[model samples]
Target: MVSVDYLTKPLDIFKEMCRILKPGGLAIMSFSNRCFWTKAISIWTSTGDADHVLIVGSYFHYAGGFEPPEAVDISPNPGLTDPMYIVYSRKLATA
Candidate 1:
């Protein structure tokens, strides 16, 4: 999936990412200020792009097996086009 806005159970997806990744593996998920609004979840459609970053980050944090995720702004031109962002988390390394 290109975006999590369409996910009905995003946290569950992240949990599975953690479960399947080897220690220290990175799991990166990205989103933008764009999506199929009708298909997106209510919260995603209701919130703005900045909030979208936080929402996606929460999926990683609450999923329970990854390091804190980072949200990066990668929009090509601030206002010229749709804004894009990425939230990535690393699976915690096993000792």
Candidate 2:
């Protein structure tokens, strides 16, 4: 959804990711403090790194069939370099 409000919707894409994955599968999405603000989605640019993690977490939550999303700090050097985070969720196992 490349509209005036959002550059892209990760939620839409995450839904597809959930649908494609097998039960008990894992989905990982990475985000960083580095991005072209003008080219990124409004929220991505408007918010800080922490909020970005919650935003990505929401994608997994609303996408359905996934366990709680978790955030991983993978930055090599927090102060020396740009910060990075890996947000992931696992597809729920079939009952």
Q: How many backbone clashes does candidate 1 have?
A: 0
Off by over 4 Å in 2: 1-7
- Return the TM-score for each candidate structure: 0.94, 0.88
By lDDT, the best candidate is: 1
Question: What are the per-model numbers of colliding residue pairs?
Answer: 0, 0
lDDT of 1: 0.86
- Which model scores highest in TM-score? 1
- lDDT at position 50, candidate 2: 88
lDDT of 2 at 1: 19
TM-score of 2: 0.88
Candidate 1 C-alpha error for residue 95, in Å: 8.7
